[model samples]
Target: MISIVLIGTGNVARHLFDTFRLYDKINIVQVVGRNEQALAYFGQYSKTGSNFSNTEPADIYIIAVSDDAIAPVSQLIANVKGVVAHTSGSVPMEALSKHPHKGVIYPLQTFSKERKIDLKNVPLCLESDQKKDLEVLNRLAHLISDHVYGISSKQRKSLHLAAVFVNNFTNHLYQIGKELCEENNLPFEILNPLILETAQKLETLSPCEAQTGPAKRGDLSTLKKQVGQLKNDRLIKIYELFSRSIQMKFSRD
Candidate 1:
């Protein structure tokens, strides 16, 4: 059995804790965090504490804290003998230098406390300083996820950057679309089918191939009309920028 000490109370920690508990081979030794109220959520399933100094010994110590707090939080468990890993896409494995065995187990999926996701579908990115620790992480990752990848720190940083573009930026665009619909007295739900189809198309078509609209077709008249329709200067600027970017991409092709 692989014992784990999860250190955080945030969305990622909660999701992981909920998923790990379901597997019989995984034993959650304890959960550590700074907030007592947040720690209470894990109290029902395992030992929960606010003090890092009293962390329990486990086969793996998974630090699911924020990126900035990773290093300092890791220092608290410097004396422990376990494979210490962090669930960060951008942060490098060196942040856990205080530990003899360091690794990374980044789940490439947005986590929400209220939203339930299938762990088996979520991509798990694994990295480690030691070969043995990598094997251990791989074993643990495979238990919950079918999509596991061994990613380097440099490669992981690049993936995180692309994720921001695909997830964060795309979501912001959705917000803009919703606002436009609301301003015109249209239901935002009207765009749901379009959004779903766009995502589903990615399975078979490359982004460039799936591309459509005035920008892709270079219909200057339609572009002008759309730009003229937007009253908000910020939204207009964003629209024009994206249109220009798309035009330039295909122009080069």
Candidate 2:
């Protein structure tokens, strides 16, 4: 059995703990965090503690803390015999330099404390300094996910940048779309089907091939009208910038 100790009680940590508990092959030895209140969520499943000095021996110590705190937290457990792995896409593996065995297990999916996701579908990116540590991470990753890739720190950073554009920026645009619909007295639900279909198209066609809109077609008349309708200066500027970028991209094609 692969014994694991998860550090941190945020969304990613909570989500991972929930998924790990379902697998009989894996054991959640303990969960540690500075916040006693947040650590309560893991109390029902594993031994919970706030002090780093009290951490028990485990096969792997997974640090799921914030990007900035990863280095400091890893330093605390530098003496442990277990393989030290972090769940960060952007942070470099060298951040765990204090540990003899360092690795990364980054899940390429957005996590929310309120929303539960299927771990089997989530892409797990694994990296390790040694072959033995890589094998250990591969075993753990394959147990929870069907899709696992050996991604290096450089490649993981690039993937993280793309993810921000696809997930974070796109969600911000959706929020803007919702506000525009509400201001125009149109039901925000009207855009739900369109949004779903746009995402669905990516399953068969690449985003570049699935692209269709006034900007892609260079419909200056429609673009002008759309920009003119937006009363907010910020929205107008955003529309112009995005339209210009789309036009430039397709024009080269």
Alpha-carbon TM-score of each model against the true structure: 0.98, 0.97
Error of 2 at 241 (Å): 1.0
- List pairs with backbone clashes in candidate 2: none
Which number leads on TM-score? 1
Candidate 2 stretches greater than 4 Å from native: none
Per-prediction tally of clashes: 0, 0
Poorest lDDT segment (10 consecutive residues) of candidate 1: 42-51
Q: Candidate 2 residues 1-253, lDDT tens each?
A: 9999999999999989999999999999999999998988887855688879778999999999999999999988878899999999999999999898999999999998779999999999999979999999999999999999999999999999999999999999999999999998999999999999999999999989998999999999999999889999989989999999999999999
After aligning candidate 2 to the native by TM-score, how far in Å is the CA of 33 from where it should be?
A: 0.9
Q: Which residue pairs of candidate 1 clash?
A: none
Score candidate 1 by TM-score against the native: 0.98
Per-candidate local distance difference test: 0.94, 0.94
